[model samples]
Target: MSQGLPYDKITSAYAGTIVYPPKGTYGPRMQQDLQLVLLHTGELELTIDGSRHAVKPGQAVLLKPQHQEYFAFAETQESWHRWITLDLASLTDEEQDYLDKLPFSMPIPEALNTMTDMMLALQNDYLRQDELMRSLGYSAFQMFTARISLTKQQELHPSVVAALGYIRQHYMEDIALHDLAGAAGVSPEHLVRLFHVHHQMTPIRYLWQYRVLKATELLSQSGLSVGEIAARCGFKTAFHLSRLVKEQTGSTPSDIRKAAWGTAN
Candidate 1:
């Protein structure tokens, strides 16, 4: 089977969120488009062509086109979920087959929530989502699939997961090794060992890299000045931001920004 599709090539056609009432049911019928469902709360049992798959809270399921699909939501409470429809006509046979062979149930990637929030900040409503935001969301889908593939290769340590979640949420703030450990509910030494084992670096190194990554995004996507971007991304100053941005991307902040706007000097 194919490993996966090129992330940049997987564009999103439409995306939206839904909340189904307890025991809600839909369709022992057909789905015409390729869609991915991310369940945030409660449960979902998807019956596709006589195969039943249970999708729990924090899980995702990829619904392929031309399937006799059925959806059964939680019986006790409302179920919250999001769906992103892929641009199906653009996929090659290998890519389509790779998606088809994917498991029916997988955990909803944390990066999806982060990406949706980031892109949503650019476009206030899904109904009014602009092409640029949709493009960014498409990249997010690729990230989801890439991360899922990596996860399938190796299960992440729970402490690493917890620490990473905290970092993603608070990368703009002042963070220390103890703070990371506290978030992961581990001691400083244990957290460091875990990071070294999984990430091949210390937690602080990861935090700094994450800050630079976010700074790069803001530099490309927002009109914020270098200093402002630095402040928002937890860099000590514009110099720090530029230094790391150059180190990580081999391009200075202004150059990256100009390139993103198609006017690089």
Candidate 2:
């Protein structure tokens, strides 16, 4: 069966390596987004929806939305792992369906080396945030997903996809949830739930994050002043943009620009 996950957009992605503290435990709760965790050293014990899964080195776990999970380092040993968090709403229906079929945990002994390398690449590209690096990161994510999934194609809801396009096209405007819902031909309440399920955030939060991301790009690539960049990125003012940027990234606009230009501000 040439069942494969469809190629879907990656809205946002980041990867990190973590070492669990001795006797560390995480969450006896549910997650709102999709997560991929790859064990590199020691062992992790996961309880998913009441089922116990022992994740060994060279193994990975794919957790879907709303899945109740609890995790801890086994035998109080320090465990090293790499994890990626993705917005699943960007998936097409086919891709989401394929993802739904995969086992919660699987051994990828042969792919250990390749997977680790890809994770590192993704982390670097995300941090750099250049146009080329962003593109490469998206491609790397697709390849990583393909290697782990057994499906051939992924698809998103047509309306949701349409809404995404609309947001991308008009992100610089003062857009509202109702506007997006109208574009998708759904009620505002429905749109909120849809975003929550797929994007793991409300539509407004997504809009804010998108604006911030765009502003950062401008800060890095353009000679525009903070006010000019803020206007172009749809902030109410430079102050508004600066506040959000600092809140989200812990960096001021000047600092971001200075870093990009290799100058001290």
Candidate 3:
């Protein structure tokens, strides 16, 4: 661990992977720090106090400190898991408070999974001597923490939650209103009304709007050209992407690129 690191960086306590044989169990033990676990194979059933959580593969759970818990591996299979532990004392008070609000468990996004795996790779000899590598490890931990924490003011409708996860996972595809409705497990008209109630727009409108938002990020940061970005973002043509960017953001892609970077994107 190091001192005087930036707020966006972290000094983690420990991180590593574990594997358990069938019917194996651990704990009746106590947690010492905030930890995030990513289960990779088989099922995990964790009982904290008296409540039980059944986590599937590709899912993650954030554990708080000071809880008595038991871990049960699948009765008929092995379980593979990866985790990163965060020391609360290493983070600022604001950062500590933010961790308090994360969902106990959630699906791991693809980007977050990559970041977590990268962080775990560093766990063997993490920050033993190199200062810059230490800082990078810290920032990696910070990145996953920020990603897992969904800072909504209120809980969204279950249908909206399902639709949002679907759109985010497949925004590059040519998605239709019916597809969105089907993913949300609602009728097309019902999904539209729900979107209007929550997002103040129809389901289809939100999809394109979200596409424009993704295009803006690429325009401001990625090296991809407008035409390539359009295809990646589900727009029909470069002109279509440009027109929407101009209409929604009051700026052309070129202007955004120039202003965002040093005369380029």
TM-scores for candidates 1 onward, in order: 0.54, 0.46, 0.50
RMSD of each: 9.2, 13.0, 10.9
Pairs with backbone N, CA or C atoms under 3 Å apart (clashes), candidate 1: none
lDDT of 3 by residue, 190-231 (tens): 998888776656777778867886897797679999999999
lDDT of 2 by residue, 1-265 (tens): 0123322343445566878877888899887666677888878889988888888888777777667899988676788888766554455567667667766666653433343454455454345343222333343343345344323213555566667778778989989888999999999898888776655567788778678868977987799999998888889999999998776554578866664564632
The TM-score measured for candidate 3 stands at: 0.50
Ranking by TM-score: 1, 3, 2
Tell me the deviation in Å of residue 74 in model 1: 1.2
* Of 1 and 3, the candidate ranking higher by TM-score: 1
- Candidate 1 Cα outliers beyond 4 Å, as residue runs: 1-12, 119-130, 154-265
In candidate 1, position 14 carries an lDDT of: 59
The best candidate by TM-score is 1
Which stretches of model 2 miss by more than 4 angstroms? 1-154
Q: List model 1 lDDT by residue over 1-265, tens digit each.
A: 1125543453445567789999998888788666678899988898999888888888877787778988899999999988767554476777777677766657777656665554444444433233444445454555555466457534778888889889989999999899999999999999999987766578888888678768977987899999999999999999989998766544578765664565522
